[model samples]
Target: MSADEKGDFISNNHQVQPIQNSLLPIQHNPNDALPSSSNPRRNPRNMQGLLKFLLETTKNEDGTHDSEFSPMDEERKEFLMNVFESMSVNIAEKLTESLKVISQAVNITQQDDPSDCENALEVLTDLVDEVDVANDFMKIGGLQACKPCLYSPHNGIRWRAAQLVGECAQNNPLFQHNAVQLTFLDDLIKLVDTDTDERVRVKALYAISTIMRGNEKAINFFHDIDACHTLMRALQSDSDRLKIKVAFLLSTAFSGDQFLKIQLQKMGFITLLVQLIMEALEGKKITSLEHLLGALISLSKDLPDALEDCRQPNLNFLNILDNIIQTYKDDSACLETVSYASSIKQMVYSYTDVINADR
Candidate 1:
């Protein structure tokens, strides 16, 4: 009786213990932090989250140090320098990852929903304005990705792309060179040539101005492609800004090679410029007038065959000067006017010597 009872009781206890273990709920810790893979706070799991975090850090109220995104703030440089340094090691990879997200959001085909495009472009603009990031931006296909946006049916996207592309080419030689190689220059020429939007045209022209600075090869390329003609036509527009930019572009091209100056003169650029100067003086748009004056002075300073060109019987630069003088005879007290007068007089006197010598 004792042996049978003991065996039965031991087997029943073992079976009961197994059932109890299977029935109990799995033990877990409520306070344990989740893995970064599962937690958005530990790591941003999506583009919106990352963008929000970045935007928050750029605000002064974020309590980090200072705002980095405010263009007018003094702390922007320090903040940008710090971020630039931190990302310097793998900036291209890091930026590429972020831009991939931004690209989708800012795609031109995003229909009428532009909230993402606006925010992303603002971020990109701030980043590129931080100095050397523009080169890195190009390295990461940022410019290529946005190229189509330049012609977005929506003006906002086109304008944003225009601004971003201009900044991408800002004072960055490599970026500018890349632009030329990648046919961005051709795109820019098209924008300036036929885009109906004046704002976009001006921005593209500004980018062309930046890209062509001290770049003789690019200037020559533009000249070879007949882009000079497009620029010259742009000068005919009534928008003073566009005219100033076109004049500036001509001045830059003239500054590049002597042949460019001769070519421009042959194309009647000098005649058109003189007419523009007279119009500027009459319109009283002081800034436009000054820029036009600067362009003429820039051309005069750089044109290798200035005296030779002035000697052309058909040019009549002295007559043009006389017309300007007759137009501004009473403006003796205006320093700018007087300065222009003196400059034109010097040109006439110099050209007169050349003419007399030819005789």
Candidate 2:
């Protein structure tokens, strides 16, 4: 914000609250695994010496297995790495192969075997999850290979392509910067605006937020556009996944910049968020309400003056907080909702105190 509007106005904020970077977990069905004719649990030795070799790696230096050991330990990594290599499917090797396969698939029968493309995409998504692998991915033209899939008619392929970009760029400044150079920002924005598939839209926005989060040029580029309105439409969307992500992205986008918060407040973001919260509470379920509440707390944190929007008597912010706390307190799943609700309740209390002191 210190820079001129036409100049570089955004950069990294090391103090920005860390986003919980995660992909929607791929639910690997046991049936999806490559199966064998013999059941290993019934009898270990039936499948040759493979089972014994696995157990041998777990043996400690004293020749007794460390029953409490976890895979995170260095010894386990060194011992188990050979087992992974022997399986002939090292992740880097297979993931590189998959990148080529998808590129070729897109060039060939894109429609004939969507499952093959989708499966290959899912495999590459694994590469994006790890930083080192993500680097290797970019070095080998992973982004260009993925571009064709982004336009695939299959919804699964499109969403997975977006997810690949989002996962690779999250919390990674170098990747974020490169994503901008490759014009991923423009493509992702267009994807969010026009994609009919809700999953695709959500992942596209996820990638956009990550790319714009800390990079100066990317954020400056976005500043000239209707970024707030794009977010507003997302909040008004029917997809709970989209709304939750948009809410979290608010914090990421607004942090370390009062000018941005002022822009949001002017754009009626506060009023819209209140309406969304009330709608979620008045309905039968409030699963995604937690993120909405967190957004409010983030946007209003440490403000010199409480928002006039929050002080509206008709909105009754305190009552809403109380209802959320009471309803979600005992519900195990909404525990985060309760905590965020409590934080905002205290925020509202502080707001009220400031209002009364002025009176």
By TM-score, the best candidate is 2
Q: How does each model score on lDDT?
A: 0.63, 0.70
Model 1 over residues 165-281: C-alpha lDDT tens digits? 778777777666667766777888888889888988898888787777766656767657388788888989877889988877765645657677777777766667666776776
Deviation from truth (RMSD, Å), model 1:
21.8
lDDT for each residue of candidate 2 in 173-243, tens digit (9 for 90 to 100): 76676678778877777777778999899888888887777777776664643756777888888888888
Tell me how candidate 2 scores on lDDT. 0.70
- Worst window of 10 by summed lDDT in candidate 2: 5-14
Provide the global lDDT of candidate 1 against the true structure: 0.63
Model 1: residue 269 alpha-carbon error in angstroms: 0.3
Candidate 2 local Cα displacement, residue 277, angstroms: 0.8
The clash numbers for all candidates, in the given order, read 0, 0
